[model samples]
Target: MTTSSLEPSEIDLTDWDFWARPLSERREAFRALRQLPRPAFFREPEQSIMPTGPGYYALVRHADIVEASRRPQDFCSGKGAINITDMPPDLNEYFGSMINMDDPRHAKIRRIVSRAFSPRMIQRFEDQVQAVADQIIEEITAKGSGDFVADVAARLPLKIICDMMGIPESGYKTVFDNSNIILGGGDAEFLPENDEEYALKLLQAGQTLKDLVEELGRHRRENPSDDLVSALVTANIDGESLTDQELGSFFILLVVAGNETTRNAIAHGLKLFTVHPDQRELLLADFEARLPGAVEEIVRYASPVIWMRRTATRDTELNGQEFKAGDKLLLYYWSGNRDESVFTDPDKFDITRDPNPHIGFGGPGPHFCLGAHLARREIGVMFRELFRHVPGIRSTAPPDRLLSSFINGIKRLPYEL
Candidate 1:
């Protein structure tokens, strides 16, 4: 429970201070964890929301994460995938989406919502993405320099998601702030100082998002627009349509997951390119040919959405490690992306790294990120516009990272054109 009690080499995943450490130190700690024969176990961090039940195993290695993801029946998500603590059923109305669900219900909701992200649907938004990226680039270029995160990286995805869901521009700030609070993970900048206010703030934020989307969903149900809300509220999937609560929860999942992860990826991409000029040069040399690889490398290197939890459904063994029913495991995707056995020179920022099987989106499972294709397009398009119009644009300082164990977020990044 205290830093003095832990050995220097024995990293405690549950410790909040461990997340506060510098990136390099955290990377070294995970490297040591990966070297271990089996996943490391740690007690749950104390929280006001739920009583600490059992501790969780840290699935830090690429092989272990992959196996766990592949065997969803053995390692289930219905107990709660986003938070390490057991989420109360009352909170599920706002926070539970397909990510927190297991098969049947998860599959049905995913099948219905997946239509909005299908290739045809994404192709329709391709022009919209380019237009938004261009608009953002122009706005930032006029200013010449500022916080790239707020100015450039955050705008594209937020606008695209809002536009897709028929959320008016007036509500963009609401969606943005609420999403930040929902995933803020006790960051002081986004949360109140009083611990008593924490749960209330979270519930209020979730309620705001739910109310915003449910109201829009009601309108879409009546008016029937060409947006995702209209499609989702009306679409029949095996004689089942998403209820208002389902729509609201899915909207929270979509906006928060879609907006924050892509924003961080873009922020991290600029930082990575700024640090490794050679890779930037290689990317700029043939922007069209090499960009696909660069985008993948960015997601791999950034590894946004640090980890997701899975509960053991039955007693089973994974890669030589055994788990009892109701056991908890945190799959550290960032660590998996850096596993030495999988990636050669894992620390290097190689834009041309081939066959990169990074689980930045997520491991191979039903819970893999649904917005990945959209995220890739958003990242790729934004960079293309930046390289074409502002080739010299780069981060001027290290990022102000979010203080969270879950999200690999950059709160702010000073940049120049």
Candidate 2:
């Protein structure tokens, strides 16, 4: 038997150039590397476009990624959950949410915030989400055509997240803009010319959100509204609640996590439907029968978040890949979603795909998405409304994707109904 091998260059997962290609092209590259021992390591180039680190392993196979997520004790996310070179400690802490933390800290935050996402609360939010989706559809219904990213895909999640937080309707755009900038990173469409201007814009965006949340938290404490913000502000476990900064960070996480990723998944749904009209027909034929599967497949196809980082807490071997304590690795969720071994016709968009275990959300771990149910509900509701309200809706052109390695985002997508 022959052991598969990979030239370091072929598997340099950190290369910005690698991510610059079409996602399909990037997936093909991962497929080409599949035989190179399930998990392969590569040292990234120094001082490139993105934050650079010493080196990291690429977990491209389905089994490898599942194992990494299953064993969070060994593959920890407390350090960072992104692939941005070497993120500064301050920045990481500022951007870090429960998703970026490991046990105890991650557990504590998760438990507290989990309160806001109870089934009863989510059920109540559903009617609001449906109304928001209708409002968004109404705003664009007569246009007959518009950039789906801005006009449709971006609206529902933005509106729902803001409404969930009890943010004033006047500030919906503000939350939407800030969430886009922070997640946009250095994308020319979102950031400024140089690193300095970009840094400043990014900081200002963070500051704006922090101040807004802080103000809202103070008001919620005084007024006590029936919303997630009020819930977070007053939430107490044995008389302990989130601090002002913690409240703000959690809000930021809610906006970014709940807004950007869900929006992207919705955007990708339109694009995917455009390409696979047959699948769309299947969905339309009997939405009740197919809605859940379609939602799962869209999340799988979009893989809205591309990958997450996990550091080896101690010397560990995954599928025979050697690792030292503190070693870094990226679990390529996008790649794993399309791994040939996992899903039949991994690249094909099948709405009825069953036994779909795609970790479009983080898989098999405590770090799994806290808002998964809400996101899925939002997607299902939005699409059901879209197909019903705008029966003739379709895209006018291919998407202009965000130029970032971390987010598999569609920056702009024109469409017509």
Candidate 3:
């Protein structure tokens, strides 16, 4: 299919209305886009906060996203990876952490911070994750039924991240609210009504998170603990440590990305199981043996992060398509996860799906998710507890989906015990 052949009215990735459609329609639209000869170009979505750029190629295929991720020198992320529009200079300090940085700088930060997220560190917290999951399940059982997102799914990641950072329980709600605002920019429930107030609100949210972490970082420097904040503040890898601003930005990235992505994955997991009972039964039959595959399938099927942006540093060709320097491309991870060429019957949620090379965390690269192991542990433990305790739990109604092109978020998912 040619660009002209597919009208914008029929399918426009940039349109907010397109994202607001039912999940099935959006999946079908992407299925059609994948069959195109080359990635289709669409005008950037208009925003009151930032000026629209020329346009961006939607990298819908798995191969294209993987290639782009591998060749970061050509399709760089330094400009911006989270947003299609260029992030303003002022916002970069808060929003532009290693995810938005190119090599050398990105490598440096990742190297220092990598120690905290290493497998050993994650394993040390394994019992903590299980404990938290048990507590959450107990609460849900006591409450009987409610919004799963709040009572169950959202609590685990939020508490885990906050505990890792040495944040007090008093600040948990603050972190949760600010992170939602940061990621839920397109949602009216979390954002202001006025268009002009959008940027200001975002800045405020970032500042709130930045201040919270900076204060903890300072305290950690004076009185260190076994928490991630303590490790980061004093981490000296070849005479390099995270600066206050860097610490703040990294915290924002960690809390928002870590909490939001894992939360959504769990939320989507319940709904997926509710819809596909056979998969749930298959999982429950032998959860210990099947859970590892189940976690991978959950991330694959319900790609929490919808897409990430990349800009061409110089002229490049990917998958036989030519592109000029400075051109923008949005790597639609959601589409890549569902590529028919990559996974057999990709739409079907099979817990025992072997060779599942899903890019839900992201395509393989320096920018791949650092907290992936921890996320898997959280989801696995949470579900293990749910299946053991609330054996008959399922979604009572369809998820109240978040209206955003970026995050496949479920604001509220009603459930019963």
Candidate 4:
């Protein structure tokens, strides 16, 4: 298995140049990578237009991605932003979520929310998930034809996570828009009506999150409950309680991370079914028994979170290629899932593909997607209901991909529910 370096000539701007194109165009680029002999990561060369002031490399191969994600010690997730650029210092100071933090602190924050995500808790939530999914499906079915993205996929995950996080149902629009705009503001089209307006939107979103955290913090203090916010407020590690900053950071994380990505996966999964009717048929046939594979395949294919970055702690050799310290590594999980070396018939969508080890959920390791099990449950149950209730569902209009490449999901999926 020989892996060749990407030549300067081969480095067309469109070679994984997701940031510069429309979602439709970007999906074409992803389709093209499927044909590449080996997985390739996108990077702005030092002389190229995009700057790497923060500094890192993009890991595009299946094996290298697995390595980079698993061994956080050597390739830490804390040095810089998970996306292509760094978050402003003040923004990071306020909204620094758990995914970016390294161990000890990362471990501590993870522990606070861990109880809510425990297997027992998750299993208990199955009925809630099913009920929510069923209700959403019923509404979709009643319409007979509706936008899957807006009517079904968008509402389910956001509502579930909002309920779990103790967020008022009314705050969802603010939370959803804020999450998308903040993470995806880089996309020129996805920016608010205007750049100046978009900036204001971002500020308001951050403030809303701040207010939410402070209010929830107070609620948790006065009358603790089993909800994640209260659990987090009450959690203690080595006699160290989560500070206001930490709690605020995690509250944003839980809301954003819990909602957006799952919503994307559900939306994208429905889109994939429209593309792969056979897989859809198979899933509909044996949904109860085969739902697990369908969920895994959805994560593998859509990979809503397209890439995660890691700054090299020191020089490292990945796939026999040496990367220097301070090099920014962008692990393209989307490309990895389609790697021919790891998956058979890589380009073909196979919901039943067994032994699937795609890193759609952050590969297999400690940082391997803490909310994965819950995500799976949500997707699986939704699909089961979708296939059963909205049997005739299909996309009525083309998808509008999120403007930002960081969170790769459909911004608008016009469809018949």
Winner by lDDT: 3
Please estimate how well model 2 matches the true structure, expressed as its whole-model Cα lDDT: 0.83
Model 3 off-target regions past 4 Å? 1-9, 118-120
Error of 2 at 166 (Å): 1.1
Order the numbered candidates by TM-score, best leading.
1, 3, 2, 4
Candidate with more favorable, higher TM-score: 2 or 4: 2
Model 3 Cα RMSD, 1 decimal: 2.3
CA lDDT of each candidate?
Answer: 0.90, 0.83, 0.90, 0.72
TM per candidate: 0.97, 0.94, 0.96, 0.87
lDDT of 3 by residue, 129-184 (tens): 99999899889999999999999999999999999899999999999999999998
Clash number for candidate 4:
7
Superposition-based RMSD of candidate 1 using all C-alpha atoms, in angstroms = 2.1
Candidate 4 per-residue C-alpha lDDT over 1-417 given as tens digits, one digit per residue, 9 for 90 to 100: 012432333434323343555544444454455455544544443423224564445456678889877778778777554545555645654554777878877887777667546566566666689888878877766677756777888788888877776778788887777776666645665465454576576667777887877788888789886666776777776777778777777767766777888999998888889988999889877877888888998888888887877777898876667777877778878778877778898767798999898898886555777788788888888888778877768886668766554677777777775
Number of backbone collisions per candidate: 0, 4, 0, 7
User: What TM-score does structure 1 among the candidates reach?
Assistant: 0.97
What is the TM-score (0 to 1) of candidate 2?
Answer: 0.94
Q: How much lDDT does candidate 3 score? A: 0.90
